[model samples]
Target: AQSVAQPEDQVNVAEGNPLTVKCTYSVSGNPYLFWYVQYPNRGLQFLLKYITGDNLVKGSYGFEAEFNKSQTSFHLKKPSALVSDSALYFCAVRDGDWGSSNTGKLIFGQGTTLQVKP
Candidate 1:
């Protein structure tokens, strides 16, 4: 029943400009959110997470996310984006349905392509 949504199919930003990839989640209980980035021909790399604590959580590649409990959102942001940063990004949440046997699984969003143009 829980789901994560990346409303945009693609996000375009000029190289050196700030970039953002939107993410919103719907689930029961405290949300365990995560962000991942994937370059072409490369596997998804863990970017950041929002399991608990402060609203803002920092991660790899100069990226960070603000966990907004009121908005049910955890959008990924980078102050400045590079051409190399262009890639597919995903937002996911830990499936906490312990009742089910498949625990520790992450329910991911549809994914958003980030295009940083020089």
Candidate 2:
């Protein structure tokens, strides 16, 4: 079984400052990690993914994440924040080796609210 943890319920940052939303995961084998963002009344939008390759992955809206295998963590980062970036973020994971029967199943962490204030 795989699971994700988002320890922070909310992250507050001033506009133009760098922001980070923590995420960690556990899985039986190698993990397939992803990040998604959701607005007040919208569905989750895919941000980025780490299936393999580079330790650092970049995604939409100038967001990026670092994959640390040893620590089993994938933390989202942004060099600079924007007031428009304020939204709910989620970290999700699935076992890379899962068979077709388990397809489309993603374990997600509790949502984290990011507030960017000017």
Candidate 3:
């Protein structure tokens, strides 16, 4: 089975400091990794993905992630945190072939709520 773990329930940071939200995944075969952000009463917004390439992948809102195959991890990072950046973060994974309508079910982690204090 495929799964993702977001070890942190919440992350608190002050505006202007670097921030990071950790994530790890497990899958039967090669996985399609994704990161998403959700605001209050809103749907998940795609952040970035690691299809296949350099270990580091960049995404929206100045966010980046490192894909470590050996460790089975893809941690999201940003150079600076903002109050507006405070929101719920989610790490998700799907099977390599999961994109097809037949298997487009995306399994998401519990989520990590970030509080960026001004």
Candidate 4:
């Protein structure tokens, strides 16, 4: 089984400062990691993904993440935080190696609320 953990319930950052939302995962085999953002009364929007290749993956809205296989971590980072960036961030993962019975479902972490204040 694969699972994602978002240790922080909320992350507070001032505008113009860098922000980070921590995420870690556990899986039986290689992992397909992804990040999504959700606004009030809105569905989750795709941010980035790490299928393979580069250790660092960039995504929408000036967001990026570093894939650290050694630590089983895929932490989301932004060089500068903005008030508009404040939203619920989610980290999701799925096992790369799936069996016939596997549904290829993604397990998401408890969402982390990013509060960017000016």
Candidate 5:
């Protein structure tokens, strides 16, 4: 079965400093990884995805993620973080094949809280 894990329950970073939210995935076939962020009163917003092509995938709000096939990891990163960037982050994985039985069903990791201090 496919699964995702965000080992860290929370990540702390200072304003203007680099920040990372870790994510690792396990899947039977090719892995489709994604990152999402949720604000206090908003829905889960797509951050980035690794379906194919380059290992490094860039997404919204200055966020980027590198898909490490060897490590099965897709950690979200930003060179500089803002206090406003603080939110709940999620890592998700889907089967590489779209025709699979669980099509469009993503296995999500435990939520991780990102706290950015001003």
Candidate 6:
């Protein structure tokens, strides 16, 4: 079975400090990893994705992620945290069993709440 794990339920960081949210995935074939951000009562917005190629992928809002194939991990990172950036983060994976025809259906982790203190 394919799955994703977000080890942390919440991450607290001071504004202007670096922030990271961890994620790990399990899959059979090549994994398509993605990160999404959700604000209060809103749908998740795409942050970044690791489909192929580069291990270090830059994303929206000055955020980036490193795809480590050996470790089976894709962790989201930001150089500095902002109060505005404090929101729910989700790590998602496209299960290959379902294939690309139905790629919209994503298997998501429980999600991590990011709290940036000013």
Task: Give the alpha carbon lDDT tens digit for every residue of 17-111 in model 2.
Answer: 99999999999988999999999999999999999999999999999999999999999999999999999999999998878776768999998
What local lDDT does model 5 show for residue 44?
97
**Candidate lDDT values, in order:** 0.92, 0.96, 0.92, 0.97, 0.94, 0.94
Superposed Cα RMSD, model 3 = 1.7
Give the lDDT ranking, best first. 4, 2, 6, 5, 3, 1
Evaluated with lDDT, which candidate comes out highest? 4
lDDT, model 6, position 5? 100
RMSD values, in order shown: 1.8, 1.0, 1.7, 1.1, 1.2, 1.6
- Residue by residue across 1-118, what tens digits does model 5's lDDT show? 8889999999999999999999999998999999999999999999989999999999999999999999989999999999999999999999886674655888999989999999
- Residue-level lDDT for 53 in candidate 6: 95
lDDT of 2 at 106: 93
Residues 1-118 of candidate 1 have per-residue lDDT tens digits of: 7899999999999999999899999988678899998888999999999988999999998999988989999999999999999899999997554565746778999999999999
Off by over 4 Å in 5: 98-102
Candidate 6 local lDDT, 1-118, one digit each (tens): 7899999999999999999999999988888999999999999999999988989999999999999999999999999999999999999998555555764668899999999999
| lDDT at residue 33 of model 5 (Cα atoms) | 92
Candidate 3: 10-residue stretch with minimal lDDT: 97-106
- In candidate 2, position 56 carries an lDDT of 99
In model 3, which residue pairs have backbone atoms overlapping below 3 Å?
A: none
Which portions of model 6 show Cα errors greater than 4 Å? 96-104
Per-residue lDDT value at 30 in model 4: 89
Can you write out model 4's per-residue Cα lDDT over 35-109, one digit (the tens) per residue?
999999999999999989999999999999999999999999999999999999999999988778878699999
